[model samples]
Target: MHSFKRVLVTGADGFIGSHLTETLVRAGYNVRAFVYYNSFNSWGWLDQSPEEIKRELDVFAGDIRDPHGVRSAMQGCDAVLHLASLIAIPYSYHSPDTYVDTNIKGTLNVLQAAKELGVAKIVHTSTSEVYGTAQYVPIDERHPLQGQSPYSASKIGADQMALAFYRSFGLPVGIIRPFNTYGPRQSARAVIPTIITQLAQGNRKIKLGAIHPTRDFNYVEDTVEGFISFLESSRSIGEEINIGSNFEISIGDTARLIARLMNVELEIETDEIRLRPEKSEVERLWADNRKARELLNWQPAYGGEKGFEAGLAKTIEWFSNPDNLLNYKANLYNI
Candidate 1:
């Protein structure tokens, strides 16, 4: 296993990033959390993490888009888990330029910095959205990438950039592509959170878009575990691996499932404003996790028949808390 004492987690303030950061700290690793600089000094979900994790963390606030800032934060770190990217698909449609600058350019900054810093290994985050509407079921690393939306297109560019650095410069990098990771701390813009928050706010009629599309949902813990597996294994260098539950469910069904778990009967409303452009909607995604198993010795523990149901129970518990539910604006359509 590759060993690194000090690791930098870019985007460490976000949902998955915060969980990964906390997990690493608990496992006795020196974690440097590079959060996006904001005047409010917000660390996103990291702010709500246990105080013990916060005490030991070296939090560096900086923008991923700034090469100088990235380099400054990365200095002395052995490895970087770059998860900083603009990911809202609907927002991307309205502002593709911001996605390009943040996702593409921000990725470039990390790659160039890692090369210069001589980092031992870097885990570059990718998304299953890059394989738009999955041409084949059980989408593997070999699946053709389709840029169906601006978000996926920017991620495709970033993924290619990471690969180019690996192939051309021989940078030790692994691309971890996760499918629809959902759990506590996920923003309201996400489907699961939107559904949960709406129910928590006593909305009997849930508003959603493009309910026909199917997704492979992997819990946040499972997704973070995949990153650690790659970080510890040298076999994954210069390769792209998938981290996902090898199962599929339509969006509408997922909403209904969450409702059942929360014990809330609801009407599903199709909000036209919430729907993606018809041509841009991804129809389906089901992960072929064989490569992750073969290469990283990883399989999702939170997947299969009862995995999603169990995960939803945990997520519902989190969102049901008045403290957690208050942070969300359930009445407003997020993004």
Candidate 2:
């Protein structure tokens, strides 16, 4: 195991990043959170983190697309968890150029800086969307990448860049390709949050798209643990490992499950605007996390049907809270 003195988390302001940051701090790791710089000075989800966690953070506000700012953020950090990127698929369709700039170019900035600084470890985040529709069940790292959408394409580029850095300059870089991750602080653009938020608001008709598509949903806590495992293991260097629950469920079933858990009867309405281009829609995803288990000795605490239900129950509890539910505009389409 490689010990890192200080870890820089790009996108530390995001949903998964925020959870990872708090977990790392609780585990006694020095974390420098690199948040997107905005005039509003919003630290994103970090703004809502506990006081103790915030007090322990060394927060730096900067844009990942800016090379100088990215380099500056890496100066004192021995390791980096590069999670900053534009992730919304529908938004990517509307703005492909921004996706290339933020996801690809931004990742390049992180790689270049990590190479120069001789960073001990760097884990770049990848999404299961990169696999597109599963041509085969239980996708492994060896699965062929099919970037059906602009968002997935940009991530594919980023993943290659990270691997290139490792191959060419001998930089210690690893990629953790997580399947669908959901939990508190997740944006309504995600399916689970969309369902939960709409229901919490007492909406009888749930708006969704392509409900037949299956996803391997990993809870935020499980995803965070996967990141930590990758960060600590030297065996993960130059490896692209999957972090996911090895279980699949269609979007329609997931919605029904949520409604059942929430104890509300509802009907799913296919929102035309929510539908992706038929060619761009990924119809299935199931994770084969054997690589993560063997290399990093990691597995999701929330795995399979029962585990998914448990995760969903916890998620529902959080989203059901009036204070949290008020933060979401459930009636509006998020993307």
Candidate 3:
């Protein structure tokens, strides 16, 4: 673990990646942030990070699809957290080709670069979506892979690619499969943000998708800690670890929880425009995090009730500010 002096995080500008990068920098590791190359020169959520934290980052603006750029970014980095991908399930339905290129090919670029650069460790991010609905109570690492949507299919392919590098090329890699992670800086495309933002906007009616489906929500900070824990623990080298809270709640219940926390009585009308195709809905997901507990020595510090409180509080505060809500489309339904 001590062999790594510098860590590189791909997708460092997104929600979870930004949080993990901040945590890594605070942990005294020299951090490199691999954000997407955009003409706007924006850092996404990293732009919203405290100036103190932003000062420590080595920002590299480049696209993950470019092999040259990926390899160059890994040159001096000892470890890499590959989180770059197009992850919206609804958007994937409309643009699956984009998902394949960004999620699958983008991952290949990172894995190959890590192998060529001899990076000590590569933590490839996976999603619980790959498991689809849980066939059993708690979906373990052995759960059969299911592609309920194009986004999940791309992730499954990406996971397989990273594992192949570990087996065929002896590249040190591990897959960190996090379930539904929600917190501050998350976009309105997600359910938590949608509900909070709608309520914060003073709308009595909250627009939402299939509220019947269940999810095991883990706060972003806990998810980031699990990623750090994986780097320090040798047992996770070739493992597929699930970073989850081991608790489940339906979307309808979740909306109610948020409303309760915010002291708002609102109707959760099922917005047909927000719903996915009937077959594409993932029925349920609750993770068996015993592997994460035993191997990473990690268990979620925030449960559903507590996580909801903190997340909703922060989300409400963020959305209450019109400047922030200006970026969100509160009038429309987001899948």
Candidate 4:
């Protein structure tokens, strides 16, 4: 394990980013949080984090697309966890140009900065979306990448760029590709939150996109721990590893499960507008997490039937709160 204590976490105000920041701070690392700057000075999810965690973060607001901004934020940090990017698939379809600029160019800026700063380690974030509809049941690192959408294409470009830097410049970087992660503070743009928010708002008919598509859902904490494990493992350098529950569940069944946990009977209403173009929708995804287990000595604490049910129950409770529920517009389709 590398002994660096100060690490920079870009996209620190986001769902997974916020959870990872809290875990890093509690683990005694000096954290520098790079949040997207806005006129409202909104810190997103971090604003809701406990005060103790907030105090430990040296928060910097900047745009990752701009090389100068990313470089400035990364200065003085020994390592970086780059998670800033445009992630929504629907949004990406509407804005492919922005996706390329942010996901690809933004990653280049981080890699260049890390190389110049002489950072010992870097943990770049990737997504399961890059795999498209899984070619195999348990998608391994070697599984062929299919860019089914503009979003996945951009991520594929970004992941390749990171690997190039490692091969060309000998940069010590690791890519952590996480499957669908769900929990408190997840944006309503995600399927889990979309279902939970609608059901919590007392909607009997839940509107969703393709319900038959399956996903491997991991809890936020487990994904965060995977990031830390990758950072600590020397063998992870220059490698790409998956962090997931390795369990697949259809979207339809997941919605029904959430309804049961919420003590409500609901009808799954498929909205045409919510559906992706036939070819663009990824029909299924399941992960082979053995790489992370063997390389990082990490195993998912929240996985399998029992862990998934427990995680969903906790997520349901969070969305059940009026305060959190109000943040979501359950009546309208979010992206």
Which candidate number maximizes lDDT? 2
Stretches off by above 4 angstroms in model 2 are none
lDDT of 2 by residue, 47-126 (tens): 99999999999999999999999999999899999999999999999999999999999999999998888888999999
By lDDT rank, best first, the candidates go: 2, 1, 4, 3
Task: Tell me how far the alpha carbon of residue 171 in candidate 2 is from the true structure, in angstroms, after superposition.
Answer: 0.8
Clashes of 4: 0
Model 3, TM vs. native: 0.96
Instruction: State the lDDT of candidate 4 residue by residue for 31-135, as single tens digits.
Output: 999999999998889999899999878999999999999999988999899999999999988989999999999999999999998999999999999999998
Candidate 2 versus the native: TM-score? 0.99
Ten contiguous residues with the weakest lDDT in model 1? 1-10
Which residue pairs does candidate 2 place in steric collision? none
TM-score of every model?
0.98, 0.99, 0.96, 0.98
Error of 3 at 18 (Å): 0.9
RMSD of each: 1.0, 0.9, 1.5, 1.0
Off by over 4 Å in 3: 1-3
How big is the positional error of residue 23 in model 4, measured in Å on the Cα after superposition?
1.0
Model with the higher lDDT, candidate 3 or 4: 4
Off by over 4 Å in 1: none
